[model samples]
Target: CRIQRGPYRCHEKTAGFNFNYTDDPNYGPFLVSVNGVAGNNTELTFWELLVQTGGNGTIIRPDVGIGCYIPEPNDRIILKFTEFVSGSHSVSGNSSNPGNLTAGNTSRLDSIELVVVNNISNTTNKTYSTDIAFRGVLIGAMRRLQTNSGFNFTYTDDPNYGPFLVSVNGVAGNNTEKTFWELLVQTGGNGTTIRPDVGIGCYIPKQNDRIILNFTKFTTNSASGSCTNPGVLLFLVGLFFCFLI
Candidate 1:
């Protein structure tokens, strides 16, 4: 079922590759010539015929005797064959169109010898093989409803979020803001804030700060439930408190 290893080089004058068929009682030995060959009296099974022709020798069908080496476009190649199976012996097109080599198996020919003329083009550059590596970047954020009725959030400062700058509720803040370094010192609050570690950190909008909710400047954090009705209500209330400043 496989072709023999190595390429079968053939010249234009070379006739079809010859094969011997063995006699079998069940199907009876038959003389079968592929491409254009004179019929002979030989009895052999279909499997045996293929095995003798180096069919199982290689990965490709070596019985075809090398496919026409098409070097260029617009080239003509012909394939013929003869099957000797008593009166029932026959031949048919293997592909879509007859006489068209590019059209796959045409002439209903079981096998054919290949001959390459000057139809295909030659390559000057030597082909080599190599492996390639690829890298990608991804950024993400999460918003969740705090068990205490507030919102909890986390985000990275990676470029995947676009430039390093981040504006929360309209106030500019860097990654250090999430660390709550100043808040911890001033308010004696624990350093429990989820600090932005990648690029810039999150900022809680202060009183008098301008803010927008659209994704353009601020995106809803699903982990913080920022887009939820309760989250939105909290944000609005915080904004109202800011205006009092």
Candidate 2:
């Protein structure tokens, strides 16, 4: 069997493995199974498409599905079996500023850096920066980026979780796809990064902080408490009490 051009074509022509996909009106074909294994939403498991770059041997997830992904000659294709957590909302990070700029001076404004990373896309990360008021929310800087730097993003305000980032730079996370923008930060540009327990509306950024907005899928084990977000917990508790009543 001769390997074909696209990923799905390659699978179709190859004899060793089997594959399956559902045709989506907007997104085209969505791969749901491979090698007799199927993705189960109830079990939170899915097949993640990945590629290893030829020369550098770096692994990356392609943003597009099998139908659209044209593999390079030397690219190593990998289909990974994985699980995901529910709920795309939530932002978290922490960083400090040692610079003298502060709101109290009224003359100097603090600025922080924003880096947009798309793990699923084979494109370069985009970097932008914006000035923030003293202890300003992340959304303000994001808005400034849109205004001055041409960077765009859209978010939904969760009544319980505040601002839930819905989309960034025209790429929106889909519930069926189980992908979202995760917020992370490097403190004082010292290289240490952390995911804050708070969302965008609650987390305050310090001067010179490097905020990383990573667009990626969620893959976590069930024992890790992935559904521990405050909003989800509250909803669960409310449902429990309603059942009791």
Candidate 3:
């Protein structure tokens, strides 16, 4: 792939890898290639971009990446290659304040980042961070991450609880058989675990929050908790009445 970054340009090609191509239905194709070298053919140091601007030189992150953005004749596509102090957004590092693009213009990257990990899989531990809109429910974030970050998540909408998370990357959390999707949150660097008080559709995420959706077993004792079962309770109550008679 040929990439143009400002005055520098290069052609990058890789086999058996799909990281460079991000295809969207509406926006066409955009390139997020990481292999572009300088015109001198040195190793390309940053992610590729096709930035659309308002001619004030303020560049907004493209609605999508290269494979998804079909260019218009009048559109300004700035090719910028930059590095991140923290390469964790999966594709983004420390972002230079999108404010550097200038004021009064809404062309800025306004997204949040969340890290996802699954304890159920035995595969090599690979790390990926999901970057999505600054404001949205957890399901919305999951959809965005599924597309951009190359992770898989599935859910079902229940009339009672709204959106119930079914699984992550093919690992299902069964609620009836005593298995569940446990929600764990870690804010800042705190080592303690905080269980969320809300469901996926109701909970909103804060920046820098590590969200762990774990598939785990229910810990209720069958003897004590079985009393909550209507069938068992009914049978026990009938026996109590017989004793009184």
Candidate 4:
């Protein structure tokens, strides 16, 4: 027959005896197992039983997780993980130089050079040293009026013109005066002196003309004016006005 009882502890020597068969104390023995393994009865206190069941193992504090152990600023960490695992992680912290974390785009050119070639005949060859940003490029002639003669002048884009202010070479009637004359000088027109009768005349000063072509205001990439202070053209104009009077 089966018997039921409240919690009870038996001494080690009598642990295997069936309490239900107390009347016939020696009638049968009880089977005992620890973690699903058959075992002979042995003496054990409650504390010992608890230890055998993993109660003494280290316990992780709830507040401290994997991230808590990371070192402070300037400490380097080498991380090796597969792409899938790495994708799950994120970084957050205050940096010494916060701007280093921001992403920006910048571009730089390889090499830049500015070249201005004057094709006029009378002016001397000149090469101006300038920064990369100021290089002006235009495929045309530079036209201006001679300060001395008040005659329209044409500065060629060819080597003959050299690099100088556009102006007439000399006085109009002088035999030696070779004026750098142009038929019609107008602003914003094709750099050409198109007088059909003169057949594109470029003033050639003869020897007798005492007047000289003066460079007043000269510039590229923008129109010439007092505000810009094209000193070369101003000089030319000053020389022409002085000679004309």
lDDT of candidate 2?
0.56
Best by TM-score: 2
> Which wins on TM-score, candidate 3 or candidate 4?
3
Q: Per-residue CA lDDT of candidate 4, range 1-245, in tens?
A: 11111001222343433322011111111123323333222321011011111234432211111111112233222222112112232211111111111111112111211122223433552322211111111111122112322234333221111122233333121112222222222212333322211111121211121122222223231122111122332344542111000
Cα displacement (angstroms), candidate 3, residue 134, comes to: 2.4
Return model 3's CA RMSD, one decimal. 19.3
Q: By summed lDDT, which 10 consecutive residues of candidate 3 come out lowest?
A: 93-102
lDDT of 1 at 177: 20
Query: What TM-score do all the candidates reach, one by one?
Result: 0.13, 0.48, 0.41, 0.12
Q: Determine which window of 10 residues in candidate 4 has minimal summed lDDT.
A: 132-141
lDDT of 3 at 190: 59
Q: How many backbone clashes does candidate 4 have?
A: 37
**Highest lDDT scorer:** 2
Q: lDDT score of model 1?
A: 0.21
- RMSD list, candidates in order: 32.8, 21.3, 19.3, 43.6
Per-residue CA lDDT of model 1 for 157-236, tens digit only, reads 22112112223222333222221101100111332323121111222222222221222112222223122122222343
